[model samples]
Target: MAIELKDLAPLLLKAERTNGDVDPSVLTNVLRGGRVANDRRKELLQVIERHPVLSDRDMMYRNHDERYNFGIKKAFHYIKLLQEGGYTDPVDQQILYSAMGEPTAIEVHRSMFVPTLENQGDDKQRAKWLPLAKNYKILGAYAQTELGHGSNVQV
Candidate 1:
C-alpha cells in the first residue's frame, strides 16, 4: 500500500486550512510537556507503526507459543530500534510496551521484574543484572502469588 504525496494533498490542505490558530504542534508539545518530548513520542510511534514485526494485525489467531515467539522477536528489535534511534528513556520504553498487544515477556520484565530488582537488589547485584535486563539479554516475569497460594491467602 504505497501512498503518494499527491493522494493526501487535498486532505492535508483541508486540515491545514481548518487548523486556524490551533497550532497542532503547540498542543502536541503541551500534551507531551515540551517539544523535545513530543518529537520523541512521535518518532517512537512512527518507528513502532512502521516496523513489520511490531504490528499485531493477526495476533489473536496465533496460539500461545506462536505469540510468545513473535513477542521475543519483537523484543530484540525493540531494544535495537530504540538504541539506534538514540532513545534511552525508560518512559519511552513504557510507551512502546503499552502500545504492543498480547501480554509477553516484555510486559512482565517491565511491570514486574525491573521493579522487583530495583527495589530488592543491592548495588552489586543491580550492576550485574541491570545491563542484561536493559539490553533484553534476559527477560523475566512475576506472578502475583506462589502457585499454591492462588487467590486464597490466610494471612
Candidate 2:
C-alpha cells in the first residue's frame, strides 16, 4: 500500500510534534511574543480559515491580472470582516493578514501609508485623514525607488 503525499504530510507533522522535546504551545507563545498574542493569532486564524473569500487555494492558478483583482476582492472582504468582528486593533489586523499567507492590495496602504500619516502628518492632517483611513473611507499607497537605490535624486 502506498501513501499519498497529502496523507503523508499529516503523519510527518504528527511525528515531528510527538518527537519534539519542547512543548509546541510554549514555543508558539514565545514566537508570537507571549500567551495573549498567541491566543489572539489562533482566534483570528480560525476566522480567516473559515472564510471563503479569504482562502488562498486558488491563487496559484490565477494569471497576474486575475491575481491582482482577486487580491483586491479579498482585501475588501477582509476589511468588512474586520469591521463586523470589531477587530479594531492594528495588531489583530496584522495577524489576520499573516494568516492569509498572501499580500492583499491594501497591505501597503495599511502598513506604510497609514503609519506615515500617523507619524509625520501634522495634527490638522491627522485629524482629517486618520479618521477617513480608519473608517476605510480612503485607501492610501506608498511608492518608493527600487530596492538598494537610496533616496538620492542624482542617482
Candidate 3:
C-alpha cells in the first residue's frame, strides 16, 4: 500500500504525544513534500511514532544495531513503494547513508554490501559472488577502518 499524507495525520499527532519533538511535519516535508499520499507512508510514520527510541534525547546515542535495523526496515519498505509508484526521487543517498551507518547485518547486506559488489566487481565476479551474498550464503563486511589513516583512506 502506498502512503498518502492525510493518512499520516494521526500518526503525527501520536508522535507529538509520544516523542514531543519529532515533528512529523519534518518527515512529511522530507518524504511527501508536505502532501499526504497513502496508507503505507502512514504505516511508516506510525511505526516511527510508536518506537521506543522516540524517547531518546540523542539519536546517535542509541544502540547502533537497533537503530540501523529500524532504518533498514523502514527504508526497504519505502524503497519498494517508491519504485512501484514510479517515484524514484524520494529515497536517496541520505536515506541509504543513514541506513548504512546502522550496525545490522541486514542493513549492510541491503545497502552497502550489495552496492559495492554490483558497482565495483566484474561481471564474472558478480555472477559468482552476488547470489551467495544476496542469499546470505556468504557474509561480507567492510573492515577497512584504520587506526591512523583517518577518513581519507579511500584516496
The model with the greatest TM-score is: 2
lDDT of 2 by residue, 1-155 (tens): 89899989999999998998998788989998999988878888999899998866588899999998999899999889888999989888888888888888988888888999899999999999998998688999776666566755553
Question: What TM-score quantifies how close candidate 2 is to the native fold?
Answer: 0.76
Local accuracy of candidate 1 as per-residue lDDT tens digits, 47-127 = 678888776657678898987787778777777776787767888886776566555547778778878888899999999
Indicate the residue-level lDDT of 56 in model 3.
30
Off by over 4 Å in 2: 1-21, 143-155
lDDT of 3 by residue, 77-147 (tens): 44443345344332442333243333333555656787899999999999999878655567676666575
TM-score of every model versus the real structure: 0.65, 0.76, 0.36
- Give the candidate number with the greatest lDDT: 2
The order of the candidates by TM-score, greatest first, is 2, 1, 3
Worst lDDT 10-window in candidate 1:
97-106
Point out where model 3 deviates above 4 Å.
Answer: 1-30, 33-38, 44-102, 145-155
State the C-alpha lDDT per candidate.
0.77, 0.87, 0.56
Residue 141 CA displacement from its true place in model 3, Å: 0.7
Residue 114 local lDDT, model 3: 74
